[model samples]
Target: MATRRFPTREELRVWRDFIETGELVRSAMAARLQKDGLSPGDYTVLLALSEAPGERLRSSELATAVGWERSRLSHHLGRMEKRGLIRREECLTDNRGAEAVLAPAGRAIFQQVNRPHLRDIREIFVDALTPAQLEAAGEIMAALREHLTRE
Candidate 1:
């Protein structure tokens, strides 16, 4: 008869801790966004476009910038457009492409949310870390992202 092997206690504890803490932080962040009236995804899109020189990016380029798939970004963009937060400008150079241009409403909402979001980020994730720790975290996160996408 083969013996069953179980995860060690530390392994189980680490996994559970990660899951629970991640969910708690996500919920808190979502609650914060319920103000400035943004969902997490909406906020992310606005921030991504805000950093662009023209406050606009091609839909496909934005999708890639955020590591979002085309269908997913399209669905979200549709919702944002309906909310008057963005406009899809038909690309003259590429008939098949369109730009996700941040609209006035989106910029307004982003401004409202930006400060609170920064506070929450510092409170929940950043404040505890030393500068060196933050640097290490950034490196680790980049490596993780690279590893996850390699396959």
Candidate 2:
């Protein structure tokens, strides 16, 4: 039987800090968004759609962009449609595919949420880091993302 090597104390400390910071940031952002009547998931979908050309994207493309599964995206889209925040349309390029478009209400809500959200992000995360630290964080995140995506 092979024995697994244990992580060193420094490795453990770094991993713990990384996970704790992520949780803290995520929770804080979720709270701020929820106060504005939006969930983190809703914000993610809206942001992705708002960034896409024509403020729309094919369902599969949206799922990829949001890092969500197809079924989860479909379910969320249905709820957003009911709330009149978004609408799904038949894709012109693919007969079997659909597109998710941000409705005016969704766009308005996102715009309304932006200022306060940005402030909260700055207060809770951004302002704590120097420019160099922010750059390093971005690079670290990119590397981590690439490693995870490779799996």
Candidate 3:
């Protein structure tokens, strides 16, 4: 029988802290977003669209930008469309492709919600970390993302 090597105590501690902190932060942010009638996923999609050129992006590009599957993005986009938050139109560049655009109402809602969202983020995350720690955290997250995205 082969024996498996266990993680070191420090490695376990790091994992635990990472997971716990992530859960807490996500929950906190979700609660605040819910109060504004938006879910995290909704905000993510809106933010991505708002940042795109002319506030529009190809459906596939939007999915990749928001790290969601096409089906999931499609479902969410349907809901958003019903809420007048976004519109889906045929892509001008590709006859078969669709595009997502942020609607005026969506832009207004995002503008209204941004201040509170930023304050909450600052209170729950940025304010809690030193500048150096914040920089390090950003680097660590980027590195992890790069590593995980490798084929």
Candidate 4:
């Protein structure tokens, strides 16, 4: 039986290379986060909250920022809350909606988790990217994320 023929190269050099690179970065970051008693998602939430306008964010917005569905965000938040890392408050503007707020414990963990995470990122990813490449990478990711979400 004959197999389908393929071209030597298509138009996916960036995509293909990135997938390989992304997994490398993810693995390194995951291991680093694990040493700090956190997962990548947990670090992301803490990072997002720390950068959020008020150290708090509406659940819906958090879900979007985290690239998670509402239910997924809720489940993660529940775990974070149980671990004393975050608190959920009923949104006054929308009785049914809630906000995820970082607590003091969460803030400290952010500092602890962040220092090592940043160092790991610097070593594993940032060092691997040139200034131009770094900017382009962010631009590409933001553009693709928006483009895909819109579709």
lDDT per prediction?
Answer: 0.92, 0.93, 0.93, 0.89
Error of 3 at 8 (Å): 2.6
lDDT per residue as tens, model 4, 12-86: 676688799889879878988888789998998999999999899999999899888988888999999999999
Across 30-125, the per-residue lDDT of candidate 3 in tens digits comes to 999999899999899989998999999999999999889999999999999999999999988889999999999999989888889989999999
What is the RMSD of candidate 2? 3.0
**Candidate 3, pairs of clashing residues:** none
The regions of model 2 sitting more than 4 angstroms off are: 1-4, 149-151
Angstrom error at residue 124, model 4? 0.4
Sort the candidates on TM-score, descending order. Answer: 2, 3, 1, 4
Window of ten residues with lowest summed lDDT in model 3 = 1-10
Each model's TM-score, in the order given?
0.84, 0.85, 0.84, 0.75
Worst window of 10 by summed lDDT in candidate 1: 1-10
lDDT of 1: 0.92
lDDT of 1 by residue, 1-151 (tens): 5664987799799879868987998988888888767899999899999998799999999999998999999999999999999999998899999999999999999988899899999998898789999999899789878999998
What TM-score should be assigned to candidate 1? 0.84
Q: After superposition, how far is residue 74 of candidate 3 from its true place, in Å?
A: 1.3
